[model samples]
Target: MATRPTMPAAAATTSPDDLLRLDRQVCFALAVAARNVIALYRPVLEPLGLTHPQYLVMLALWERSPLTVREIGQLISLEPATLSPLLKRLESAGLVTRDRHPEDDRALAITLTERGRLLREQALQVPPRIVATLGMDVEELQALHASLSRVIAASTPAHQPRR
Candidate 1:
């Protein structure tokens, strides 16, 4: 671990400008933005019977079904403990199957059910709705996604979490 650099007592006690305000903090902005964006998706996702996190899971499964729980967690940045209940709820809704992998009985495989496969048609509407709701040009949103991707990569730890 690195140690904090020591500063003179007078320097440590004062700010040159009033820049330590909450509205100026990047973390505060990120937190509020994350909440508001997720809130926007709430109403949009209601008809599909999905919460924000569930939607993320569905997106992973939509791209490729029969993924292992660990793979889904890695893709979605969720821990298994957090993801388990979501999988259970999806299973109960008959949208997905949590069964043993055909090749390896010990590993759980998450495959979309027939109903879930059909839901993809409805899911196709989601992106456009979100874009309209944000009232941003697709180019701008794409730029922001690229920026956020960079932020995530820069802020993430050097070591990946254990699978």
Candidate 2:
């Protein structure tokens, strides 16, 4: 078997390296965007007494009450291992409760508390502020969102359980 010849580092840079170029790598951009976006959310969420992850959990419960922990985990694209601590914190904060499911003895149901419901009213301001902080117009933001959604759909592992 013949070994392929290696290009010198200088030679590799002479050509337009599609691999290194920003536009060509969706994951690279997405990772950076996710980090920056989360950073933006941090300050916005502080006053609400929620972390970004907790805020997401609240959003899910606010939209639909009485989701099981497993159900919330699936809807939020989180594994039970990752969600357990967050739910524990939320429960401790008096925002949510975990109770045994009536029909399914094995699963635990998660319900938002009155405090959590009231928190939703305060949360209404968060999204608009996030959008404004992005400093991108609606069209740019929409296009970015749609493109990222497509990438997520294509790249996420298959056979994940649905809520």
Candidate 3:
């Protein structure tokens, strides 16, 4: 049988108070960092006429268009309720078109417009700008991304058969 690794003795010896410290809390750090990083994207995305969430949606569509609302939500880890309004706004901006799927009347297909496709040219500059603003090299950001992926996987629930 395989065994799980344990924390080192020194780390295991942390007191309850040490564990309770706000600065040491992963959730606290993640929340603050998320807000700050999103704030950094605000100015960059503003000229592109997209908020951070909208930009994320565009990024997904740029990769694969004509995805259903549910598929886009799954790709972005956003709820359908939240994504619906964002899609509407993008449609309003003429960046995308949302139409009922011919095969599945209930499903809405999201496709980027010609303007949206052209916007990708401008959007290409965003990453390099953000990287410059963050002062982090591509390698460092890649490593951070890998670490965050591990953290996300560890935090999500594992599906198991019901008893």
Candidate 4:
């Protein structure tokens, strides 16, 4: 089987008429890569009882707990409408608690539960597993991440993550 090319062979050389090709579309490439990469996290997260979105929320909390709903949304680039359900599910899972922020009664504060905190230990294995699964060099993945970050920033206005 032929290995996938790391990058396109000189997109600049492509004819103007090929501009409409699906293979040449950045949006198309990003869309498929995003879906496939997220899919790869499924089994890796299953043992921890977290979906990809939930895992992301947990990641944000692990770094710093007791964040407001809006704060978490901003950190994860999710809107309130989309984030609310994930928060609710996390709460129901007994992994986190959601309450009114101490200083701001209107904002919901999310804090990790004891179980959630302990889960972090198991979560530690996740990254290595994913890296092994991809069989990609750590440096290569880091480069890809940086490139993707740039794409995200360029696509988003004022670095406000677009969900």
Candidate 5:
């Protein structure tokens, strides 16, 4: 076998036109797919009086109750400013409660009410139900999830930027 010389690393630039191709842009496809997936959840979530972001907050709370507002924001990737209003809405709807943390006066902890805990039973079906509705079996869904998880893991930065 014969070996060929490697080109200089800096000589690998592609034309702007080529770079702009949709097939080459992973971010574009990911954005479109996320939008479409969220759209599918609209009807499912509407009857429960929850927006997608709210549903995400509920998910975190349901997994483990009594997380501080800042903890919830970190888990859901939302800012405190944005999460405050959502928490208020959930509070208004009688789903969650925001109270002062026992140990820290400045920190507010969020807890699920009885109603919120009950909501978790209903939401539990959401994952498998949504998967079944997509016409994919366990194996296919697992494969897709694994692939997307890899992509997300790679895309997320080690140190998130401060807001």
Candidate 6:
């Protein structure tokens, strides 16, 4: 059986200064982990012609097509300013279409094109490839996901003014 790698021990004596240490910062660790994991997706997504953010937008659209820009932003936790350029690029790639909503002149509705729909089949391979690259078991990944979800929930402010 393979042994799991262990983290280095923390200082035996806890000092107030320990709280300020770089290694002890959760935000730093989370940011590093996010960057590293996203880096792992870069090569895999390249063949599909997507950047990490574009891949996320595609994932949202795959789950539910014809979503409004606002809806996609809400689902992906991105601002419209950030998502608009992505949608425009996807539209240019012939993967998606942006149309003015029938009922709301101000709203833009995003829909997957035929190419986008077909890309889903290729995307089906991405998760398994990522799992293999991570070298983690499904159960372990699930537990980590649960813990991260808890952290996100705890860190999010209780009151958010609706946009």
* Top TM-score hit: 3
Instruction: Give lDDT tens digits, candidate 5, residues 1-163.
Output: 9999886553357765876788778789888878988888888888788989999999999898899989998898889999999999999999999999998999999999999988888887777767766777889878988999887676678644556
Best by the lDDT measure: 6
Q: After superposition, how far is residue 31 of candidate 3 from its true place, in Å?
A: 0.8
Off by over 4 Å in 6: 1-13, 159-163
* Deviation in Å, model 6, residue 148 alpha carbon: 1.0
> Lowest-scoring 10 consecutive residues by lDDT in candidate 1?
10-19
Each candidate's number of clashing pairs is 0, 0, 0, 0, 0, 0
lDDT of 6 by residue, 28-113 (tens): 99999999999999999999999999999999999998999999998888999999999999999999999998889999999999
Question: 123 in model 2: Cα distance from truth in Å?
Answer: 0.2
CA lDDT, every model vs. true structure: 0.91, 0.89, 0.93, 0.92, 0.87, 0.94
Q: On residues 1-163, what C-alpha lDDT tens digit does candidate 3 reach at each position?
A: 9999998785699987888889988899999989998999999999999999999999999999989999999888899999999999999999999999878999999999999999999999999999999999899999989998888777756733344
lDDT, model 1, position 144 = 91
Candidate 2 lDDT for residue 150 = 77
Cand. 5 Cα-lDDT: 0.87
Model 3 scores worst on lDDT over the 10 consecutive residues at 154-163
Expressed as tens digits, the lDDT of each residue in 53-96 for candidate 2 is 99999999999989998889878889888998999999999999
Q: Candidate 4 or 5, higher TM-score?
A: 4
TM-score of candidate 2 relative to the true fold:
0.83
Q: Write the per-residue lDDT of candidate 4 for residues 7-81, one digit (tens) a residue.
A: 456766777789889987988998998898899999999999999999999999999999998988998899999
Q: What is the TM-score of each candidate against the true structure?
A: 0.85, 0.83, 0.92, 0.88, 0.82, 0.88
Superior by lDDT: candidate 2 or candidate 3: 3
TM-score of candidate 5 relative to the true fold: 0.82
Displacement of residue 78 (Cα, Å) in model 4 is 0.5
lDDT of residue 42 for candidate 4: 100
C-alpha-based local distance difference test score of model 3: 0.93
